[model samples]
Target: MPPPHSLLQLIWLASPALPVGGFSYSEGIEAAVEWTGLDSEANAAEWLSDQLHLSFARGDLALAAQAITAWRAGDAQRIRTLNDWVLHTRESAEFLLQTEQMGRSFVEWLKLHHADTAEVFAGLPATYPVAFAFAASRTGASVHDGCLAFAFGWAENMVAAAVKAVPLGQSAGQRILARLANEIPAAVDRAMQLTDDERQAFAPLLAVLSARHETQYSRLFRS
Candidate 1:
């Protein structure tokens, strides 16, 4: 470990306000609300929490851990393979754009900090998950810690969206976040053992919702 408080450094690894442009996208929550009957703040929160466990948190974090392991081993080829898989598997055009935009933006900032590090790309060829993993691993965060932080960030983002979309009280949004804390550990456990071949998840519901959001009358977030 780098030091007693080295874990704090991981905070920088996945900062929501980083140049990665994360706030510009709502990770399909907007679509889920518009298409499904998940219109209320409470319903949106529930849907997002379930999604955090079943799909986004599980699939992305696993790939991130794998990328971190490969990066640590100095296996550039494996890292590239992980990147390629993300490129192929993130089927939605909007979703792919979100990941690639965030990944490239993250790489731009990361290279500023990790210059001279082997294979550090000026533009990340890896997906957002892998980029996040590499950044956290480089900063001495444990794989579990990294994954949880990643999930927490997205969870919080959904809460923000609920606050905007449903006229939910700020306190209610915080309560939703507190509720997610209880569920994250079980999801993290599943993410740790997730295999690349098992990356496909039944999240087509969100995809369909997102496609519909493009035509929805009004929305709080970009799909």
Candidate 2:
């Protein structure tokens, strides 16, 4: 169980403004738009909506929830194993690099705030889910909030990408965001039930697109 102060810590850790460089990447949405001719706002929205519902919400959030549970149980080895496995499993080199970069940044930021007690967890992969769990556990956040936050954060990035690639109006983006809020709770619930192994996702098409984006003469995202 997390102490009260730990909950506040978790909130801070998960804040969008934490400077993790997550905003720069669209998890391959950029490439999808460039290569697949998903150029229109409506086309981008539908594709993003499906991808969010089918892939990220169902997969990554589930893994992150499991990781949070493991972290709360003080299972350091499980945390490391999960993060490393996720790192290797990511098919795109750029996507893998993005996660690793953010993970390392999150851990480094946490280190400056934690005392000697958290030093061991510091060197772990610091994957987004692992970091989210570490923050939640340390801050006393419930499993529910951690999972929701993780899902919401991921969902928002997709929405952000939609806003950019779709070139949707700001109000249109906000509308999409509002519509998404209704889906998140259910997604979080589904995620809570998954085990680490079950969290695996093989998004080969998306991976190939992302890798291809690397050689695209003009690219905006790191992955």
Candidate 3:
């Protein structure tokens, strides 16, 4: 089993303020608003809510939970396989960049704090969730906690994106975040139970919006 997790470390790693450039990409939200006419706070809230349940929980969160187990068990082969799966499943080029950049940044953070295992992670093909799994593995966080933190971080970033792109007020953003938070626990629970073959990230709308976002003339997000 892994060592006891530091609550502070989990919070810190999940913070949007971390230097991972998470704040820069709207994860296709910008494109959804501009290209697809998703222009209201209510619309944004619903979109994020659906994403949390349909895409994130069923896909990345499950992968992260499984990977935390692999990392804790010192199963390097499983870790590499998980990493490759993430790389292969990205819906678009920009999505791929977001995962790779954030994964690299997270591993760099790990290097600063845990140099010994940093080299191990650095050698693998890092995707954001995969890198996060390795980071959480050291913390001995339960799969639920690890996936919750990951989802919370993604929620914050997405809310920040909406606040900027949809021009939602800060209060509106908080409300959105609150709604997203309410869904995290259940999503985490579902993710923890998924087997590898059951995992999926195939959100067609997100993929379409992401591809359109890449060439959008007046875009505010990376992907």
Better of 1 and 2 by TM-score: 1
Q: Each candidate's TM vs. the true structure?
A: 0.89, 0.87, 0.95
Give me the runs in candidate 3 sitting further than 4 Å from their true place: 1-5
Q: Summarize candidate 3's per-residue lDDT along 115-147 as a digit string, tens digits.
A: 685569656758889888888877766767777
Model 3: lDDT equals 0.87
Clashes of each: 0, 3, 2
lDDT string, candidate 1, 1-223, tens digits: 4455556766655456677877777767766655566676578668767787777755776787777778778787888888887787774677788788888777777777787533666344756777777787776667777777777776776677766766578888888888887788778778778787776545777777666766778875666
User: Which pairs of residues have clashing backbones in candidate 2?
Assistant: 6-138, 6-139, 7-139
RMSD score of candidate 2 (Å): 2.7
Q: Pick the candidate with the highest TM-score.
A: 3
Where's the lowest-lDDT run of ten residues in candidate 2? 116-125
Looking at model 3, the pairs that clash are 27-223, 28-223
Reference-based lDDT, each prediction: 0.73, 0.72, 0.87
